[model samples]
Target chain A: MFRYLVRRFLQMIMVFFATTFIVYALMYWTGGDPIQALAGEKPVNDVLRAQLTKEYGLDQPFLVRYWNYITDLLHGDLGNTLVGRPIKDVLADAWPITIQLAVIAIVVTILFGVTAGVIAGIRRGSIFDNTTLVLTLIVIGIPSVVLAPLAQYLFTIQWKIFPTTAGGDASLWDLLLPGIVLGSLSVATAMRLTRASVSENLRADFVRTARSKGMPGRRVIGIHVLRNSLIPIVTFLGVELGSLMAGAIVTEGVFNIPGVGYQLSKALTTEDTPLIIGIVSVLVVIFLVANLIVDLLYAVLDPRIRYE
Target chain B: MTDIHVSSPPTVGGGRHLLEVKDLFVEFHTRDGVARVINGVSYHLDPGETLAVLGESGSGKSVTAQAIMGILDMPPAKIPSGQILYKGENLLAMPEEKRRQVRGKEISMIFQDALSALNPVFPVGWQISETLRTRAGMSKKDALNRAVELMDLVKIPAARARIRDYPHQFSGGMRQRVMIAMALAMDPKVLIADEPTTALDVTVQAQIMDLLGDLRRDLNMGLILITHDLGVVADVADRIAVMYAGRIVEHADVRNVYKHPAHPYTEGLLDSIPRLDSKGTELATIKGLPPNLMRPPTGCAFHPRCKYAKAVCTTETPLSLDLGHGRTSACHFAKEMLDGTLR
Candidate 1:
C-alpha cells in the first residue's frame, strides 16, 4: 500500500507539472497585450515600454519566461500582479472564502443529495423517486449562470429571506446561499450517481445474504448497500471538491462575494498573467491531490480492488 | 396440493417437522404478465436429515429457497399463498420482526456463487461473525474467535490466518466453505443451501457435499440441499424432490428415485447424466426447453417436454399420486413407470 501511494504521489507530481504547463501555454497563446493594458489606453513612449517589458520579462521568449516562472515557483515566489500586489497575498486573501464555500457546498451535497438519493433508490418508482428524478434533471439542465442570479432574485430580493449580497465582513451565514448555488449542479450529479449505484447494489446477491443473516432492514441498507454505493459517489465528490475550490464565478459574482473565482475574473479583465498562473497552478495541484485521495479511498471502500 | 404429501405422520406428540413448506405458490408480477413460479410446492425436513431439491434451470428450486428465507423481493416476486412453517408456526404469517429473529438465528441460508453471496468489502471472518455479534450479542473479540472456530469446522485450511482475507481471495471451494461457516454461525435448526456446489468444480463439488453432509449429521440440523446435479444428490441426500416447471414431479427416497424414477422427467434427468459405461455414445438429453413461466403449457407443465406425452397428458394435469413406501409422483402413469412397463 505504501508503495502504491508513493507511485501515486510521483504520478501526481508529473500530472501537476504537465497541467500547469498546459494552462500556462494556453494563457500565453491567447492573451492580449498585457503591457498595453498596464499603460491604460495612452500611447506609450518606446523607452518606457521597453523598460517595463524588460522588468516583467515580457521581452523574453515563451520558453525562457516559462523557465523563469518555474524557477521562481521553486524558490517560493509567486511573482506580483500588474498593479504590483504580491500574487501570494492576493491568493491568501481570496482562498479561505472559496474553501469555506466549497466545504459547505460539499457538506450540503452529501447531507441532502445522498439522503434523497438513498431514499429514492430504496423506494424506487415511488412519488419521492419520481419527484427527485424530475428535480435533479431540472437542476442539471439550468446552468449556474442562469440559476445563480435567479436564485439571488427569488430568495434574497423577492422573498427577503436571505441576504442580498455578502458584506465585506462575510460570515459563513452570508455565504450560505451562494454556497448552495455553487453546489447545485454537483448536488444533482451526486444524487443521480448515488441513486443509480444504490439501486444497482440493492439487488446484489450480498444484500440477500445480509438479509438472510437476519440483519435489520435499516442496517442492511445503511451498511451493506450504502458502503458499496459510496465508491462512485466519493469519486465524484473528490473531483467536485477540486472544482468547487476553484470557485464559481457566476455564484461569487451574483452574491458579490470576494473569492478565488472573483479574483481570477478580475485578473482576466486586466490580463494579470502572473495572478492567473499562480491561481491556476494551485488549482492544478489541488485537483491532482484530490484525485489521489479518491484513488486511496477506493481501496478502502472495496477490498476486491487491489493496487500493487 | 397432495393430501398425503402434506399429512406426514407426526412425531410422537403429533408435532410438525423442523421445517415445512406447505403448498407454497409464488408468482412474479412482470411487465409481460404474472409468471407462476412455484405451484403448490410442499416438502418437509427433519432434524439431521438432508433433503435435496433437484431441478433444471428455471424450475423454481432457488426461488423456493429464497421464499423460505424471506429474501425474495415483494411486488415483483410475491407469495400468493403458502405456509412456511417452523416448529409448527407459520413464518409467512409471522411479523417481520419475529421472522427476522428466525432468520440467521433459527433458520439461515447459504447460496450458490459464494464469491457474490459474500459481501465483497468485509473480511470473511467479520462476515461469519456478524450474525453472532448481532443476534447472539457476542463481543467483537469473542465473535471473531468463534468465527475462526466455525471456519475450522468447515475445513478451511489455516482458518486463523485466512479468516482476515476477503471472499475473492479464496478459491471457489474455499469460498463456499466460508459461506458454509457463515450459515452455521448461529447453529440454525434449518440450513437452506441453494445449489451450494453448483459453482464448484467436479472434485470440489464432491468435497463440499461431503462437508455439508457431515456437518448436518454432527450438528443434528435439517439440511435442504437445492441442486440440479443428480450425481451430487445420490450420496448426500436422504430424500430428493425432483422439480419440473415450478412443480414437484416426483418426491421419494434418493435410493428409490435412483433405482426406479416414478416421473418421466426424473427418468430423463437420470438418463442425461454422463456415465463411463456409456462412453462414445451421444449423451442422452431431455428434449425441448423448460416451459416459459409467463405462459406455461396446458395440463402437466412438463407435458410438452415429456417423451411419453399423450393426448390425455396434454389435456389434464396429473395429481400428486401417493405411491407406497413414502414416495409420490405427479404422473398419470407413475405406477407403470416405476414397474418398467411404461413402454
Candidate 2:
C-alpha cells in the first residue's frame, strides 16, 4: 500500500512538472512582446532589455526555462514577485484565511447535510423528506453568488444577526457568515446526494436483513445505510472544496477576506505573472491533495478497496 | 444430515407451533388499482420443518414473506385481511414497532443477493454483530464475540481474522453464508429465506441448501423456503405449496404434489420442468405469462395457460377443497383427480 501511494506521489510530481511547464509556456513566453509588458513602457534601450531578459532567463527556450522552474520549485524557491516581494511570502499570508473558511464550511455542511439526509431517507415520503427535497432543489437552483448576497441581505442586514461584510478580525464568527453563505448551496446538494444514496442503500437486501435481525432503524441507517451512502457525499465535498477555493474570489471580495482569491484577483488586473503563477501552483497542490485525501478515504470508508 | 443437534433458540414459541399464516391477503395499489398479489394464502410450520413456497415468478411467494416480516414496500402494499400468527400472536394486526421487535428476534429473513444485502463500507463483523447489539442489547465486546461465533457457525474460516474484512472480500457463496450466520445470530423461531440460493451457481446453490437444511435441523427452527425453483426445493421441503397468479393452486406433501398434482396449473408447472427422460423433445411451456393481477381474467386466472382447462374453468373461480390431513387444493376436479376418476 505504501509503495502504491509513493508511486502515485511520484506520478503527481510528474503531473505538476507538466502543468507548470504548460502554464509558463502559455502565459508568458508564447504571448506577444512580454518584454514591453514586463517593463510597462519605461522606455529602456536594447542593453537594459537584454539584461532584464537574461536575469529572468526569458532568453532561454521554453523547455529550458521550465526545467529551471521545476528545479527551483523542488528547492522551495517560488521566485520573486513582479513588485519584488517573494512569491512564497504572498502565498503564506493568504493561504490560512482560505483554509479557515473552507474548513469551517466543509465541516458544517457535512454535519447538517448528512444528518438531514439520513432523517429524510428513513422517513422516506414524510413531510421532512419533502421539505428537504424542496430546500435542496432551491439551494442548487440558484448560484452561490446570488444566494450569498441575498443571505447577507436577509440575515445580516435585515435581521442584524451577522455582519454584512467580513472585518479584519480572525475570530471564528468573523468567518461564519460567508462560510454559511458559501456552503449553503453545497449543503443542499450534499444533502440531496446523501438522501438519494441513503434511500437507495436502505432499500437494499442487507438493510432488510439488518432490520429482520432486529437492528433498529438508526442502526440500519448508521451502519448498513449511511456507510454506503457516504461515497457520493465525499465526491461532492471534494468538488465543493475546490470551487469554494476559486469561488472565494467573489466571496472574499464581498466579505473583505484577503485570501488566495483576493490575491489572485489583484494579480489578474495588474498582470503580475509571478503572483498569479504562485497562487495557481498553490491551488493545484491543494486540489491534488484534497483529491488524494478523498481517494484515501474511499479505502477507509470501504475496506473492500485494496491500495495495490 | 441425521444428527438432531438442538439449538436453544431465544424465540418464545410456547407449546403450539412457531408460525401460522391464516388466509393472508397482500394487495398492492399500483397506478391501475389495488391488485391482490397474495389472496387468501395460508400455511403453517412446525419446529424444524422446512416448507417451500414453490412457484414460478410473480406467484406471491416473496410478497407473502415480506408481508410476514412487516417490511413490504408500502403505499402500494396493503394487507387488507390476514393473520400472520407468530407463536399465537397476530403479527399483521400488531403495532409496527412491536412487529419490528418480533422480526429480528423471532423471525429473521435472508435475502436473495448476499453481496448487495450487506453494507459495503463496514467490516463484516460490524454488520454481523448488528442484531446482537441492536436487538439483544449486548455490549460491544459481547457482540463482537457473538459475531465471530456466528461467522464460525456458518463455517467461515479464520473467523477472528476475517471479521474485519468487508463484504467485497468474500465470494458470493461466502457472503450468503455470512448472511445466514447473521440471521441465525438472534436464534429466530422462523427463518424466511427468500430465494436464498437463486443468485448462486448450481454447486454453490446445493451447498447453501445443504447448509440451510443442516442449520434448520440443528436449530430446530421452522424454515419458510421461498423460491421459484421446484428442483431447488425438492430435497428440502417436507411439503410444497404450488402457487399460481396470487393463489395456491396445490398444497400437499412434496411427494404428493410431485406425484399426483390435482390442479391443472400445478400439472402444467410440473410439465414445464424440463424432463431428462424426454430428450430431443420440445420442452413444455405454460404458453402465456401469469395474468396481470391489475386486471385478471373474469374466472379462473390459469385457464388461458392450462391444457386441461374446461368450459367451467373459464366460467367461475374454483374453490379450495379439502383433500385430507390439512392438505387442500384449489381446483375444480381436485376430488376427481384424487379419486383417479379424472383419468
Candidate 3:
C-alpha cells in the first residue's frame, strides 16, 4: 500500500508538470502582448516594451521561460499578474470562497442525489421511481448555464430569500442558492448514476442471498444493495468534483461571487497569463488529488479491491 | 452403480414431518400474462432425510425451493395460494417478521451459482458471520470464530487462513462449500440446496454431494436437494421426486424409482443417462421442449413430451395415483407402466 501511494505521488507530480506545461503553452500561443495589456490604451514605446519584456523574462526562449517559472514555483513564487500583483496573493484571496462553494455543492449533491437514487431504485416501478426518473431527466437536460440564472432569479431576485450575490461577508445561507445552482447538473448526473447502479445491484444474486439469510428488507437494502452500489457513485463523485471546480467558474460569474473561478474569468478577459496558469495548475492538482482519493476509497468500500 | 452406497433411512418421528408444502402454487405476472410456474406442487420432508427434486430446467424445482424459502420477488412472482408448513405451523400464514425469523435459523437455502450468491465485496468469513451476527445476535468476535468452525465443517482446508478470502478467490467447488458453510452457520433444521453441485465438475460434484450427505447425517437436518442429475440422486438421495412442467410426475424411494419408473417422464430421464456399459450408443433423449408456463397445455402439461402419452392424456389431467410402499405417480397408466405391461 505504501508502494502504491508512492507510485501515485510520482504520477501526480508528472501530471502536474504536464498540465502546467500545456496550460502555459496554450496561454503563450493564444494570449495578446502582456506589455500591451499592461500599458492599456497608452501606446508603448520600444524601450518601454523591451524593459517590460526583460523584467518579466518574456524575452527568453519558451523553454528558458518555463524553466524559470518551475524554479520560481519550487521556491513558492507563483509569478505576477499583468498589473504586477502577485498571483499567489490573488489565489489566496479567492481559493477560500471557491472551496467553500465546492464543498457545500458536493455535500448537497451527494445527500440529495444518493438518497433519491436509493429510494427510486428500491421502489422501482413505483410512483416514486417514475417521478424521480422524470425529474432527473429534466434536470439533466437543462444545461447549468440556463439553470443557474433561473435559480438566481427565483431564489434571490424574485423570492428575496437569498442575497442576489455572494460576497466575502456573505453567510452560508447567502451561498446556498449559488451552491445548489453550481451542483444542479452534478446532482442530476449523480442521481442517474446512482439509480442505475442501485437498481442493477438490487437484482444481484447476493441481494437475494441476503434476503434468504433472514435479513430484514431495510438492512438488506442498506447493507447489501446500497453498499455495493456506492462504488460507481464514488467514482462519479470524484470526476464530478473536478467538473464542479470548472462549473464554479460560470456559477461564480452568474452569482457575482468573488471566488477563484471569478478571478480566473477576469484574468482570462485581460489575458493575465500568469494568473491563468496559476489557477489552471491549481485546478489540475485538485482534480488529480480527488482522483487519487477516490481510488484509495475503493479499497475502503470494497474489501476485494486491495492496493497491494 | 455398484459403488453407490445409500445412507441409512432417516429416523422418522412417527408422522411428524419437519417441513411440508401443501398445494403450493406460484405464478408470475409477465407481459404475456400470468404464468403459473409452480402448479399445486406438494412434498414432505423429515429430519435426517435427503429428498432430491429432479426435473428439467423450468420445471419449477428451483421456484419451489425459492417459494419455500420465502425469497421470491413479490411483484413479478406472486404465490396465489399455498401452505408452506414448518413444524406444523403454516409459514405462509405467518407474519413476514416471524417468517424472517424462521429463515436462516430454522430453514436456510444454498443457491446454484455460489459465485453470484456470495457477496463479491465481502470476505467469505464476513458473509458467513453476518448471519450469525444478525440472526443469532452473536458478537463480532464470536461470530467470526463460529464462521471458521462452519468453514471447517464444510471441509474447506486451512479454514482459518482462507476465511478472509473473497468469493471470487475461491474455485467453483470451494465457493459452493463457502455457501454451504454460511447456510449451516445457523444450524437450520431444513436446508434447501438448489443445484448445489451443478456448477462443479463430476469429481467435485461427487465430493460436494458426499459433504452434503455427511453433513445431513451429522446434523440430522432435512435436506431438499434440487437437481436434474439422476446420477447425483442415485448416489445420495433417499427419495426422488420427478417433476415435469411444474408438476411432480413421480415421487418414490430413489431405488424404487430407478428400478421401475411409473411415469413416462421418469422413464425418459433414466433412459437418457449415458452408461459405461452402453458405450457408442446414441444417448436417449426426452423429445420436445418443456411447455411454456404462460400457456400450458389444457390437460397434462407433459403430454406433448411423454412418449407413452395416450388419447386420455390429451384431454384429461391424471391425478397422482398411489402405488403401495409410499410411491405415487401422476399418470393414468401408472399401474400398467409399473407392471411392465404398458408396452
Candidate 4:
C-alpha cells in the first residue's frame, strides 16, 4: 500500500506538471499579448514591452519560462494577473466560496441520490422507481446553464425566497440555491448509477444466499446490497467532484457568487494568464486528490480489491 | 451397492420426519404466461437420511428446494397451493417472520455455485458469522469464533489463518466448503445442498460428497441433495427421487431405483453415464429436450422424450403408483418396467 501511494503521488506530480505546461503553452501559443492586454489604453513602445517581457520571463525560451514558473510555484508564488493583482491573493479570496459550494452540493447529491436509488432498486419497477427514474432523466437532460438561471429566477426573482445574488457575508442559506443548481445534474447521474448498481447487486447470487440465510429483508438490502453497490457510486462521485468544480463556473455566473469559477471566467475575458494557470493548477490538484482518495476507498469498500 | 442400502437404515427416529413436502406446486408469471415449474412435488426426509432429488436442468429440483427454503422471488414465482411442512408445521401457512425463523435456524440451504453464492466483498468467515450474529444473536467475537469452528468442521485447513480470506481467494472446492460451513453454522436440522459439488473437480466432488455424508451422519440432519449427476448421488444418497419436467417420476431406495428404474427418464439418465466397463461405446443420451414449462404437454411432460411412451402416456397423466415398501413411480407401465416386461 505504501508503494501504491508513492506511485500515485509520483503520477499526480507528473499530471500536475503536464497540465500546467499545457495551460502555459496554450496561453502563449494563442497569440494574446498579456502585456498589451495589461497596458489597456497605453500606447505600445519597445522599452515598456521589453520591461514587461523581462519581468515575466516571456523574453526567455518556453522551457526556461516554464522552469521559472515551476520554481516560483514551488516557493508559493503564483505570479501576478494582467490587472497587476497577485494571483495567490485572488485565489485566497475566491477558493473558500467554491469549496463551500462544491462540498454542500456533493453532500446533497450523494445523500439524496443514494437513498432514492437504493429504494428504487429494492422496489424495482414500482411507482417510486418509475418516478425517480423519470425525475432524474429530466434533471440530467437539462444542462446546468439553463437550469441555473431558471432556478435563480424561481428561488429569487419570482418566489423572493432567496436573495438575487450572494454577498461577501453570504451564509449557508445564501449558498443553497446555487449549490442545488450546480448539483442537479450530479444528483441525477449518481441516482442512475446507484440504481443500476443496486439493481444488479440485488440479482447477484450472494443476495439470494443472504435471503436464504434468513437475513431480514432490510438488513439484506442495507448491509449486503447497498454495500456492494457503493463501489461504482463512490467512483462516480470522485470523478463528479472534478466536474462539479468546473460546473461551478456557470453556476457562479448565474448566482453572481464570487468563487474561483467566477474569477476564472473574469480572467478568461481579460486573458489573465497567471490567474487562469493558478486556478487550473488548483482544480487539477483537487481532482487528482479526489481520485487518489477514491482509489484508497476501493480497498475499504471491497476486501477483494488490494493494492500492492 | 449393498453398503448403500445398509448405510441408510429405515428412519431410526420413528415416524417423526424432519421435513415433508405435500403436493407442492410452484408457478412463474412470465411474459408468455404462468409457467408451472413445480407440479405436485412431494417427498419426506428423515433424520440422517440423504435424499437426492435427481433430474435434468429445468426439472424443478432447484426450484422446489428454493420454494421449500422460502427464497424464491414472489412476483415472478408463486406457490399456488402447497405445504412445506417442517417439524409438522406448514411453513406456507405461517407468517413471513415465522418462516424466516425456521429458514436458517431449522432448515438451511447450500447453493450450487459457491463463488457467486458467497459475497465477493466480504471474508468467508464474516459470511459464516453473519448468520450466527443475526439469527442466533451471538456477539461479534463469539460469532467469529464459531465461524472458525464451523470452518474447521468443513475441513478447511488453518481455519484461523484463512478465515479472513475473501470468497474469490478460495478455490471452487474450498469455496463450496465455505458455503457448507455457513449453512451448518446455525446447526439446522435439514441441509438442502443444491448441486453442491457441480462446480468442483472430479476428485474434489467425491471429497465434498464424503464431507456432506459424514457431516449429515454426525449431525443426524436430514440432507436433501439436489443434483443432475446420477453417479455422484448413487453412493451417498439413501433414497433417490428422479424428476422429469417438474414432476417426480420415481421415488425409491437408491439401490432399488438403480437396479430397476420404473420410469424411462430415470433409466435414460442412468444409461447416459459413461461406464468404464463399456469403453469405446457411444454414451447413451436422452433424445429430446425437457419440455418448456410455459406450455407443458397435455398429458405427461416426459412422454415426448420417453422411448417406451405409449398412446396412453401421450393422452393420460399417470398418477404415482405405490410399489411395495414405500417405492412409488409415476408411470402407467411402472409394473411392466419393474418386471422387465417392457423394454
lDDT per residue for candidate 2 within A24-87, as digits (tens), equals 7677654555567667768769998898889888888877877787788879999887778999
Provide the RMSD of all predictions against the true structure, rounded to 1 decimal: 3.3, 4.4, 4.9, 4.5
lDDT of 4 by residue, A53-169 (tens): 888778799888888888999898988887778888888888788878988899889888878888888788999999999999899889878898899888899999988898665
Rank candidates, DockQ, best first: 1, 4, 3, 2
DockQ of all candidates, in order?
A: 0.88, 0.69, 0.75, 0.82
For residues B253-278, write the lDDT of model 2, one tens digit per residue: 89988888888777777787887899
Question: Where does candidate 1 stray beyond 4 Å?
Answer: B1-15
Q: What TM-score goes with each of the models?
A: 0.96, 0.91, 0.95, 0.96
lDDT of 1 by residue, A170-271 (tens): 899999999988877888988888899999999999999999999999999999999899989988888899889888887887898889999988888888
- The DockQ score of candidate 3 comes to 0.75
How close is candidate 4 at the interface, in terms of C-alpha RMSD after superposing the true interface residues? Answer: 0.9
Q: Which stretches of candidate 3 lie over 4 Å from their true place?
A: B1-14
lDDT of 1 by residue, B1-343 (tens): 0011233355455657888899999999989899999999999999999999999999999999989988888979999898988777788987788788888878889989999999898999999999888778899999999999999999998999987899999999999999999999988888999988888898999899999999999999999999998988888999999998889999999999999999999999999999999999999999989999998899988888888888889889999999987799999999999889887
Which stretches of model 2 miss by more than 4 angstroms? A29-51, A123-135, A148-160, A167-169, B1-16, B339-343
Among incorrect, acceptable, medium and high, the docking class of model 2 is medium
Indicate the fraction of true inter-chain contacts that candidate 3 also forms. Answer: 0.81
Clashes within 3 Å, all models in order: 0, 3, 0, 0
